[model samples]
Target chain A: MTPSKQEILSVAAECFMEQGYHATSIDDVARRLGATKGRVYHHYASKIDLFFDVHREGMARLFAAVEPARETEGDGATVLAAMLYAHALAVLENHTFESVVAQGVQMHRFGATTPGQRSTLDELIASRDHFEALFKNQAAIAKKDGSLADVDISIAVKTMLGGVQWSLIWYRPNVDSSARTRANLAKQMVRTLIDGVRTRAALQQDKPERRPSRAK
Target chain B: MTPSKQEILSVAAECFMEQGYHATSIDDVARRLGATKGRVYHHYASKIDLFFDVHREGMARLFAAVEPARETEGDGATVLAAMLYAHALAVLENHTFESVVAQGVQMHRFGATTPGQRSTLDELIASRDHFEALFKNQAAIAKKDGSLADVDISIAVKTMLGGVQWSLIWYRPNVDSSARTRANLAKQMVRTLIDGVRTRAALQQDKPERRPSRAK
Candidate 1:
């Protein structure tokens, strides 16, 4: 049976994440799928095309997860927290695709792409900027609403996003598997990021710190 | 004039960071130095060797910055914050080397290195693990002292380290130049990570949140 494009992309994303864009080839993707290079070629004209598609699909998944949270009725901090939670879960669940997205971002940043691929790279970067803007806007609102601490919104948002996104490099799914584990991990990540920016009063009510020893 | 090995590593690190290991050649590094490949080859046997050296230097710089803070007389929270601040500065100041370090970590993680280079890769990995252990031990102490929140020490440390390290990917020195900017950026990052884990009372006194209006 001929594998579908989505199947091909899934296998290709895994190969790319494992081997990297420069090292991964259509044959590698095909072999991983237990198929021939022709099978992959039928879906993707070239390796670069397949790579960009995986990147685009990864961004789409992130949007699907967080867009709802962005639209949900809540204060800025609440909305930002919801969006961050959704994003962390999406990253954990779609690890391979997100890794590709990260690779694509680096490729563009370092001018590793060919001239022909520049347009697609630009589109991907724009999507990333848009995604970042969502968090930035909400963070600004949260600051104005007095829910967040007096921090630089741009730096705070970037650092928070960076913490969540770096999961691609560090999170090993094989070691930490299970739906509960994933959810708990996402919750922990969200709490750290959101609480990092929450107002002192709000943070006090949210998760009170451990009691200090009198001796100390 | 014969360029020193340190000079070659710095140039090679810039080449590797900008163009990646596969695309960057010894000739490219030498050309960027306005010399011949012989200069680079004289100091290093192969491109992989140079790459590993850059990775080692990067790790060494990080240790130089953070190890002092580790030994300072202070509580865990104070120690961790100092270490993180020093780390952020190291990453920003040595952006090229740190970028190479990040690339090396990813390369090793994804099995991109050849069998010949595996031992060196293992050594680099060990160094990275040692660095993380410093943060983990201090976080444990902070938690015990009731200075930190009741979060998983491992997760919190990894996430905090991730946020600071991801600066290598997002920080642009050309755009945000000056010593003051770098120092301020590091301070902000340390505050977010440390405050995120600090007890509510501790955070409140350190940097009070903006007051909210009762009209809302």
Candidate 2:
């Protein structure tokens, strides 16, 4: 809750995101803050506690932002639009956290041994499940109302999550293509999901401007 | 190649796939092979080299299988069918290599810092470009002949590649889904490429599945 602790957590999240958990050390976190290890130790019991805070904070912010849209009285499509727009902004705001969580997924598949690493992993997974829970409930509601197509929420969740998480690898927030510009691509994603890029109706007559189709 | 070296590469690939690159030590591979570190180090200069060999071998096998598909005389859709089928099998066969390569992509972005890692990255990128080259050419031919829908080959390549590569993270050979099941899925993928999933006619339909006009 202290000002110095908040500042340290912010820098530590950046280092962890860029360097990874195994490669990172608490000393590096302290060094980035121009502080001593003793100072960090004073604020936090251990590195694991700091990592948990980062994971928890990241998830809490995302869920809080999307919760309003999820609770709004609108069609499923509108709710999805609101949720995705919020996701895009969150991804843009915390680029490092998004990338770090992705690395955490790989680390999770192979369990980490250190108490710090394991605790971080558990918190990360719990956050992910919570995020997915929102989407799953919305998906169920939409499906029941026929605003969403019939599809397995599990597979669809992975695909949707894949698009969002994986895009972070390629998404460059340049001055020309600002976070908002990259976020505009969300429309295309929404179009692809609701109407489907290869929707049966869309393919009946080849649109002349459609990009080169790869069949073979 | 000597049989021992080839065997070592194969075992290393499996170990890396199952346990991940950072988690799976050279000792683990040796143990899996029922050999000692002496034998492994004798063959591979380092763990990175061993992993690179596995990546190269897996990629070569993938391209070799798809060569027939690329050269086959058929419409774009048919050629794509062959390409998809070949990729699906190779994917299941090289699941471990596939996963390691996936992790390698992340590691490369972070701080891989080794000759073998760089070389493997180059080779993998080149092989993917080569595969895309074949698909693009076939797509052109299909479009010229009116056999396929219009699409962006560049984006299509990303989607198909991402779709297949991402599957490695979740695919389990022990599952009830057989190769035949995937083969059908691949075929459907090909079909969707030629015909968009939603079609214009479907969008224009005025009624639900059972609703009929009274013509009053």
Candidate 3:
């Protein structure tokens, strides 16, 4: 029996993560899905289409997971912390797809195997930018509210994003660790990240230190 | 005449970054070096050997850049800020090799094409761990000094390290921006990241508000 589209993507993500984009073939994906080439081709026009679809699905999943937190009523710092925690969990749960999505931008830059789909690339970039903007706006609000230090928003945003994204590299799914434990680990990291950017005034009524002096 | 080993490694890094480890071969490296295959073979037994050497050099460069700050006498926060900035600069300067090195660990995990080089892989992992320990120790000290909020040191260390390493993905050397300008950008980022985990008490004598409740 032919597998569903979701089933195909799940198997395909595993293949791409293991063997990489260039090495994974449509036939291999079909074989993994326990379906024929005709069944696979019926769903995806080509291998490139399949890869792009994986990228899209990954971004969509991220937005779905975090967008609700953006709508929650809270101070900017509160919202950001919540959103980052959600993002970290999503990454851990959907690592295979996230891995492909992470490489998508780099692959696009090299014009590797991605056919003339500038619109698709733009759409993906736009989605990514929008996701970042959510954090950037909240960060600015946090600064304005005196909860965050007066730091460059771009730098702050990227740093936070990087930390959450990096979890994919180190988080391994094993029988020993429960999903709750992994989620808690991600939560702690997100708290550290959000706490890092928060203004010192919030904690100690102390003056916020800019850059510390380098000892000669 | 054959190029030096250093020259060969440089070209090989470019090739691997562009074409990937599986796709790039020793012959390709030789062609890029404008030398015969024999010359390439004389210095390296296989492409895997060259890759391991690149990983070693990248780790060495990172240690060279950040280790001095570890010994500096100052507040732990100050020392950490200095070390992160230096590490960022090292990443930007040694981007190509660092890119390859970043993939090296992931490649090893998959047991992909890396032949009986368990010792080399273990050595690289040890170096990576040692480098991270430097940051981990400082973060712990920062917490003890009351400069940082009481948070998990492992989480803080990985978050900071991830932000610095992410620069390799986005930073590009260009005529439009001078090295100094790029370095300064990295510095600003490092400052924001270090400040993120710091205890607000260290910065604010003014008791800033925490968790601003959302306005209904």
Task: State the iRMSD of every prediction, in order shown.
Answer: 4.8, 4.7, 4.3
- lDDT for each residue of candidate 3 in A1-216, tens digit (9 for 90 to 100): 978999889888888877788889999999988899888898999887888899889999999899888876666667777788888888888888998887777676554453477667767878888988988888887777666666778877887888778766666665416788777778777766766632343233334345587759
Computed on alpha carbons, the lDDT of every model, listed in order, comes to 0.82, 0.62, 0.77
| Candidate 2 clash figure, as a count | 16
Model 3 CA deviation exceeding 4 Å by range: A114-119, A175-177, A197-216, B175-177, B197-216
User: What is the DockQ for all candidates, taken in turn?
Assistant: 0.29, 0.16, 0.38
User: For candidate 3, what is the recovered fraction of reference interface contacts?
Assistant: 0.36
Residue-wise lDDT of candidate 3 within B9-96, one digit each (tens)?
8899888877778788999999988899999899999988998888888899999989887776666676777788888888888888
DockQ of 1: 0.29
- The TM-score values for the models, in the order shown, are 0.88, 0.74, 0.87
Per-residue CA lDDT of model 2 for B1-216, tens digit only, reads: 233987888788888776666667889988888888888999888888887778777777778777887776665555664675577567766677666666665556665567856767777667756766876776666656555444555444444444445556555656726868665544443333233223333333412432476869
Query: Tens digits of per-residue lDDT for model 1 on A34-77?
Result: 99899888888999999999999999999999999888666667
Query: What local lDDT does model 2 show for residue A204?
Result: 38
Model 1, B1-216: lDDT tens per residue?
678888888999999998888888999989888878888888889999999999999999999999998886665566777888999999999999999998888888877567889989999999999999998898888777655666777777777888888888789979887889999999888777666523344344433544465664
Q: What are the chain A TM-scores of the candidates, in order?
A: 0.89, 0.80, 0.87
Going through the candidates in order, what fraction of the true interface contacts does each contain? 0.35, 0.07, 0.36
Best by TM-score: 1
